[model samples]
Target: MLDLRDHFFVPDAPAVELRAFTHGLMPKTVPAMMERFVEDWRERGVDAWNEVPNHWRPGSGEVVGWWTLPETLGDAFIAPLLGAPAGTCIMQPNVHWTVQCLLSAPEPFTAGRNEIVFSEGAFPSVQHSVYQWAAMQGLRPRPLPLGADGFVHVDAVLDAISDRTAWVFLSHVGFTTGEKLPDAALHAVAEKAHRHDALFCIDGYHATGSVAVDVEALGADVYVGGLLKEACGSTGNSYLYVRDGLTLTPRLSGWFADADPFGFQKQPQPHPDVRRRFLAGTTAIASLYHAVEGLRLLLDAGLENVRTDSLAKTALAIEQAEAAGLTLQSPREAERRGAMVILAVKDAAALCEWLKTQGVFTDSRQNRVLRLAPFVWNTTADIERTFAVLEDGLKTNAHQHVVAPASAGPVT
Candidate 1:
């Protein structure tokens, strides 16, 4: 197994650490770190640590301000996304949660003739769920094709918009190709959508911590992310950001978002003007607790530093792969890329198997691309070792291919 000690808090070798699964181990300093955050929250006069009414209870355990869940944890994580903007509403949950919330709104939040435009390559569940929901409501779901290089054509996306388009949604990074869309260009698309009275929503799951982000600077009306990939935490729980003063009645109406969830009224009163309006039901306390600690670690490390380190590592990986004669799949220009380095090859499945045997971990795409992701925890030596194994694998495969040309068949 790769030496993930620097990335993980585990001091022992990953292979020998059998006390718990990798996910079960909490950061050693999480308790101290969380206590500091609680103090910070109290200093802000929010009183997040205090025990409120029973209806306000999110879950048990040492509460990190009114149940950690996606909402509270998202607010802490939003500092990185929003560049620490004050008074911004951060909604942390999955894309499905966001969709559910959007679909549940009453009178003022009605779907009506509203349309949502999305790139086909975005998360399947989110794209399909929103599409099906819109269809049932007599609204149109527009699918735009991404280019062969994995970039959605901004011109084509702009052309698809019409007077009835209510929202334009897309992923900041293409999961298949590991290609990052130009933020400025996407923001321009958002501007066009806004001109037609459409809200711009971006799935930042692949973009968030892997790349530096500022939702306010990007001007996206809504952004979603999870800690699993970038922030290095457990999955399922994630976050959403809704710009200040932007009100939409949530479709998935639950106890959390209600104006006074405890009020015994048959109908819910007007929703709160704050970010809580987008929250539904109780927060995922444990995940939120850990996620908050994870975010603090990232923030303390500084996003600028993280971006610089990732770019340097990715550049080195690309250089090494090219030297080994692998076709580069991701864009060469650093500014146009994310943290992942993708290399195109003929025998992707065979190469992946060979790499695995050599203890070099990587992911393979459906086409012919091998993705190498070197997170903040990865070091220069790790990249070097990975390329050495890749070089050996390629050379071995090449020798076999040349020996049995007829049996080798055509390159994939």
Candidate 2:
């Protein structure tokens, strides 16, 4: 029997050739590719104004810039997630960075000040970042909780709105149950926010490349996504989009954000261009280049194909888990789900370890949910192999405590 762990395990080969359905943390050739891309971009007059030092060095390429290659890859992959145009601004490389940048902006808020709202049960990092941003701006942040259906209660979110609400932030997909928020319902919420003169932002990290995305059609003011989740890219990078004509003051400013970075004048001027204004510091050229390649690969393979295969694999896993009497945590409806499927089982951590011994690879969440993320590289065969290992692991659960030997201390 084929081992799922063997298929998904990170290989020692170069990242350009490595093929595995991973969490999209970091790819192999990212660093070198980024450095080369940046150098080429500079040679093409992209950074002529900045006159920034050629920080790319041999052997010790680690200190190239403030952001790493993984960070750049993370950001670039989010472009598809945000449905932003090719030249859209990316503030910060991760979701937290994007939220913080938005929150810190110098926008004025009054009694009718625009409000920001989000579903409560969304990623805590994003929620907390937005909350902190609001506090810094002296604005109240509102969180509407999800319903028993494990989906964000749209009515509840709408009802929480006040004249002061300026923005509505939400996740395109639920992390806990892998439920997709209705696009029509979300668009209605966006309309409501606009009616209240507020902006709507979405965290598409969970949705993005995993599902079909068309930012223009969604009509959101801003959208954020991380490459690691669905884009088959590295971590530390993320992307954000601000609709074509929407204008807002950027809270964070860096040398790269200046309109004429190469100007030797003591006073610096911010770029008038929307895309350049939000960008701070230098680009993670190495990772960004690799991420572009990964994105191209996904696009070439066709997103529809990826989605179709992902859903089939998820369904298979769910079927097998249910047959084994494991509680399902993911949403049942196909329209309400994404690539990752969740299974609620007792002793999930132990199960994960046991499955590892059987060469089955999977992840467990804090709450007793086992998460099986099958990506474009995964096949139906992998799903079957995983289920077989899980079946064997379940059979040995009763004797696991005494039968599994304790490990000795590592060598000094």
lDDT of the candidates, in the order given: 0.63, 0.64
RMSD of 1: 7.7
TM per candidate: 0.80, 0.80
Look at candidate 2 and tell me the lDDT of residue 368.
84
Segments of candidate 1 deviating more than 4 angstroms? 1-7, 10-64, 67-71, 103-113, 398-412
Q: Which lDDT tens digits does candidate 1 get at residues 65-156? A: 45433454454566555563544545455667775565444322233536778888788756877777776776677888887656677788
lDDT minimum window of 10 residues, candidate 2: 12-21
Q: Deviation in angstroms for 113 in model 1?
A: 4.3
Task: Tell me the tens digit of each residue's lDDT in model 2 across 199-219.
Answer: 788887777666777777777
